[model samples]
Structure formats: structure tokens, C-alpha cells
Target: MNLFELVEQLFEQYGYLVLLIGLPLDFIALPIPPGNSTLTYTGFLTYKGIVEMVPAFGSAFIGAAIGLTITYILGYKLGMPLIERYGKWLFIKPSLVEKTQVYYNKYGNKLLIICFFIPGVRQFIGCFIGMIRVPYRTVWIYGYTGVAAWVISFFSIGYIFGEQWQYILNVVEHYLKVIFICLACSFLILLVWNRVKREKAKKLSNATRNE
Candidate 1:
């Protein structure tokens, strides 16, 4: 059967447990039924009263956290040795890891906030951050924030649109990356502008004090 059909059946049979298990699996790149569709479908189920909204969100968030922690721990404990030993089988290469390192270096931890919105990046992000030795505290803060945003966005779509959820999801998937990039740029610009304004104010205050 198709993924959508599979997800529907799973949800029908298991309810909130589907999200509890499925989301974590997705984070580890298993994606048995896929994250986006699964989340949206969960929202739909909530709307239909097949599952309670609070528990559904809880299941999704906790599941994602578990998955992220698992992958991060794997990367942290094993480091490059694990990758070198099994990279070929997983299609992961040292070169790919090096490139990810460069990207992480350039972007810093802020990437964790938006990585889930991006496709392939989300699957490997926890491990990548751990491999590069970013502290778990930083990952926990930014990564969990991203997880909440991701779950809310897709789930709300399903809840809000009802029968139109699938159509809306298709459109969103097409433009998700571009939309997030624009938002990230705008946030950075605002941060820079605020910093400049603060610095100027500090300088003016110092000059007045000297006078």
C-alpha cells in the first residue's frame, strides 16, 4: 500500500501511538510514514475527535526529542570512528561530513532552529551537531524549539483546513524551504539592526559622560 494509506491504517489502529513512534523514527531517517503527512494527519484526527489534541502534540514532541537525543548520542559517543567504519553502507562519506562541518561553522547553532523545515538536513542534523561537538544544551534549546514549530505548523494546517489538508500540504511542501530562508534572513537582519542601534546608543552615552 501507499504511504498515505499505510499512515491512515496505522493511525486508525493505534491512534496517538502512531505519532509517538512515527515521529522518532522519522528523526532517525527511518520515516516509516513521513513526518509532515503524519503530523498533518494527526491534526486531522484531532479535529475529528479520534484523538485528543493535547496528547497528540505531546506524543509528537516527546517522540522527536527521543529521536534527536538518540542520534546525537550516537554521533557524540562514536564520533568519526563509527562513520568511517560504516559510512559506506549508509552512503555517508567523510567528505559529506566535512561539508556539513563547514556549513555548521558558517551558520552556527541558529541552524538548529530551522533545520527541521529543510528536508534532508533534518534527518542528519542531530548527529551532525554532535559529531562537531556542539553541547547538548544548545541542541536541546534550539532543536526542541524547531520541533515545536514543525509539529504545530503542519498539524494546525490539518486541523484548520479539514478536508483540504492534503492540498494545502502539497503546496506547503513545494515552498517550505524558500519561505523559511526568507524568515531566517529577516530575523538576522533585525538582529543586526538592533545590535547596531544598541552600540550607537552606548557610544553616545559614553561621549556624553566624558563631556
Candidate 2:
């Protein structure tokens, strides 16, 4: 069966436990159900009264935290050796890790919050953070909150849309591409604007000195 069908079967049989277990596994990059679709489906169930809302949300949040924590710890304990040995399989190069570390260092833990929203990014971010030795407290504060917000948002969409919840998956997938494009354009604009400002300032300074 397809992933959504499999997820539906699991949830129908196991309910909250499935979410509690499944979410973390997905976060850890397991080839299980997609986390977003699962969470949204749970929310739809909650609206139908098949599952309680609080427990569903709580289970998802906890599952995500547990999964991320495990990955982070693994990254911390194993360090570069693990990456060097198996990173190629995951397509993670040492150069990419170095670049991620540099960006994380410059931007601080806020990137951890933003990473959760990016598909294919959330899976690796925890490991990278842990490998870089970010404080556990910082990870808990930023990482957990981000996961919580992400879970709640998607779940809420499912709950609000009720029987139409399936549409959310398509909407999310489409919007994500649009959001990424917008972000890229914004970043480029800011970079060019900053360069132009600096050049203007330098030219003005030179003119003053010459006068």
C-alpha cells in the first residue's frame, strides 16, 4: 500500500500510540510515514472524535522531541568519525558539514527553529547541531519549541479542514516550494542591496576626503 494508506491502517489499529511512536521514527529519518501527513491525519481524527486532541498533540510533540534528542546525542557521541564513515550514504559531505557549522555559529540557535519548517532539512539539523556541541539547554529551548509549533500548525489545519484534511498535504507541498522560492529571492535582494549601500558609502567617503 501507499504511505498514506499504511499510515491510515496503523492509526486505525493503534491510535495515539502509533503517533507517539511513528512521529519520532519519521524525525529520525526512518522510511515510515511522512511526519507532516501523519500529524495532520491525527488532527483530522481528533476532529472526528476518534482521538482526543490533547493527547494527539502531546504524543506528536513528545515523539518529535525524543527523535531529535536521540539523533542529536548520536551526533554528539559519534562525531566526525560516524559521518566520515557513513555520511556518503546519506549524501552528507564533510565540506557541507563544515559549511553548516559555520552558518550555525554565525546565526546561532535561531536557525534550529527555522530548520524544522524546511523539508529534508529538519532531519539532518539535529545531528549537525549535536555534532557542533550546541548546549542541550539551547537545543531543548529552540528545537522543541520549533517542533511544537510545526506540529500544532499542521494538526490545526487538519482539524479545521475536517473531512477535507487530505487537501492539506497537497497545499503544504505546493506552498513549500513557493516559500523556498520567495526566501531565495528575498535573500538575493538583500545581498545586492547591502552591496550597493556599501559601494555608495565608500564613494561618498572618498569624495569627502578628496574635497
Candidate 3:
């Protein structure tokens, strides 16, 4: 069978086992779309009475938490040396520039909490925080909080909408709307941040020239 067929069959036969395996791999740097798919699949399973909603949520939560923690530790330990040795080799020196440094320097650690909820930044933040050797307890605090919020949000949607496909569709539609709204907000924030940084650089440069 093709890949899609294989996945469909897997979900049909052994959803819980498939989820437990896939989620961890996805979190630990595997190129897999585990996020929405797993949640949606679990909901479908619940609708079919193949799995209990509570059990599915709990298992997925633990799986995600453990998986993310592993990545966080790996990032903390391995990321810095690599970044230091050949950041430019990876085309990331621009982000490692003065502006990002200033942003990190000013934020002074609270960025960890915010970064955990943001999509692309979360992985890098885990690495940066890990490299800095931020306390394990602190990491766990924000990390678990993040996992809890994410799990509760998605699973509840699945559970509440589990009875009918149309209900599930509405739930997914709502999520899509929110995701797009967040995307728009992110774009606007980036635009503003870039503008502010440019103006600050101009002012700093003029002041240095005068001095």
C-alpha cells in the first residue's frame, strides 16, 4: 500500500500505539506532522468508540511532554557548540546578530515562557535555554505548562466534538481560523519589530558618528 493508505490502516488498527510512537519521534526532530494529525485521528477513534477520550488525551499528553523534554535537553547540551563553531555555515548568523542579542539580553529569561507557545521559535528557544543551562526545574515549569495548555486545548476540542464528523469539522475550522489569525498577528509583530530595530540602529550609528 501507499504511504497514505499505510497511515490510514495504522490508525484503523492500532491508534494508541501509533500515536505513542509517532509523537515522540516527531518531537525529537523527526520530520513528521504529528501535531494536528494525531489529535484529529484520536478524535476520529473516539467517535468510532475504539478509544476513550480521557485515556487518549492522557497518553498523548505524557507522550508529548516526554518527547519535548528530550529535545529540550538535547538542545541545551548540543546546540551551543554547533552554533559557536559554524553558525554562519547554517545561515543563522543573521539571527545571531546584534539585534537578536539585544532582544535576548533585554528580555532576560522571561522569553522562555512566551517562546514555548510560539511555533517555529519554540525549538530554538529550547536550544538557547538549554545552552545557557537554565535550571531544569525552570525549564520543566514552562515546558509542562506549555504542554498542559496545548494538550488541554486540542484534546478538549477532540473530545467535545468526537461524536460527529461535522462537529469535528467545525472544531477544526475554528482552529484554522485561530491559527490564521495568529499568523497575521505574527507577521504584524515581525514588521513592527524590524522597523523599531532599524530606527534604533540608525540612532545608535548617528550617535557614534557624532561622538
Candidate 4:
């Protein structure tokens, strides 16, 4: 069956349990019913009076938080060690880690606030933060805030649009992908420029020292 049909069937069968289960899977990167689909459908059901708004939202939020916490704990306990052992197979050497650490020092913590809206980023962000040893306090503050915004925005879309939710969701997702692509390209360009600038400075300093 199609994705929409699958979600509708599950919701019909399990009610809020689906949210409690499905959202966690999505956050854990399994995404069987997909987080976006679940939230928007919850709002759609609320609009149809089949589901209570507050409870549905609460279930979603709690489920997401649980999943995020699990990933963080796993990363904290195991991620770096595993990478140090097996990262060579994945080409994740120490130099790569250092470069990533540099970028994370600059933008990673703040990125949590909007990571939920960034598609592929949302799934691994909690683990990433933990792997970098970012404090739980920072994750709780920025991460939960981002989750609230994400849930509210997509849920509002389905509720507000009502019968057109599926169409609207498709349109919204398409544009978001385009925007993310553009932003990723720009970020890469800036990174390349910064690297070149640093290299030039290093070479210039070496030349001066030799003279």
C-alpha cells in the first residue's frame, strides 16, 4: 500500500500509541511512518475531531525526546570509541575528526535549535552532540525547543490546511529540500574559502620566517 494509506491504517488501529511508537522510530532514524507524516496526520485528525490536539502533540513530543535521549546516551557511551576502532573503514581518521570538531566548535551547538527542520540532520543530531561531548543541559535547552517548533509548525500546517494537508505537505517538503540544498552549497563554499585563506596565511608566515 501507499505511505498515506499505511499511516492512516496504523492510526486507525493504535491511536496515540502510534505516535508514541512511530515518532521514536523516526527520531532513531528508522522512520517507518516518518515523523513529518505522523505529526501532520495528527493535526489532520485533530481537525477532524478524531483525535485530541494536546494529547497527540504531547505524545509526539515525549516520544521524540525519548528517542533523542537514547541516541545521546548511546553516543556518549559508545560512539567515539567505536569510531576510533572502526572509523578507518569509514575513512573517519583523526584529522577528519579534528576538522569536524573545529566546525562543531563554531556552529554545532547552535545548530540544534533548527536541526529538526533540516530533514536528514534531525535523525543524527542528538548522537552528534553527544559524540562531541556537548553537555546534556545544552541539548535539553536547544534540542527540546527545536522539537516544539518542529511539531507545532508541521502540525499547524495540517490543521490549518485541513483537506489539503497532503498536497500542502508535499509542496512544503519540496521547497524545504531545495532550500536545504542551497544552504548546504553555500556552507561548503564558505568552508573551502576559509581553508584556502588559512593555507595562504600559513604559507606566507613560513616564507617570512625563512627570510
Highest lDDT scorer: 4
Candidate 1 lDDT over 51-167, as tens digits, reads 788988899888888888888888788878878889899998877777657756677677687778776667888887888777878887888888888889989998899889999
lDDT of each: 0.82, 0.81, 0.64, 0.83
Clash pairs, model 4 backbone: none
Candidate 2: C-alpha lDDT: 0.81
RMSD in order of candidates: 8.7, 5.1, 4.8, 1.7
Where model 2 places Cα greater than 4 Å from the true spot, the runs are 1-5, 84-99, 181-211
Q: Which candidate do you rate higher for TM-score, 1 or 4? A: 4
Report the C-alpha displacement of residue 174, candidate 3, in angstroms. 8.4
Query: Model 3, range 50-144, lDDT digits (tens) per residue?
Result: 67777787777787777677877886778767777787787766345434545554553554554434445544555566665667787677767
lDDT of 1: 0.82
Candidate 4 lDDT over 3-35, as tens digits, reads 866777777898788888888788788988778
> Which structure among the candidates has the greatest TM-score?
4
Q: Which portions of model 1 miss their true places by more than 4 Å?
A: 83-106, 177-211
Query: So what's the TM-score on candidate 3?
Result: 0.66
Off by over 4 Å in 4: none
TM-score per candidate, in order?
A: 0.74, 0.76, 0.66, 0.92
Better of 1 and 2 by lDDT: 1
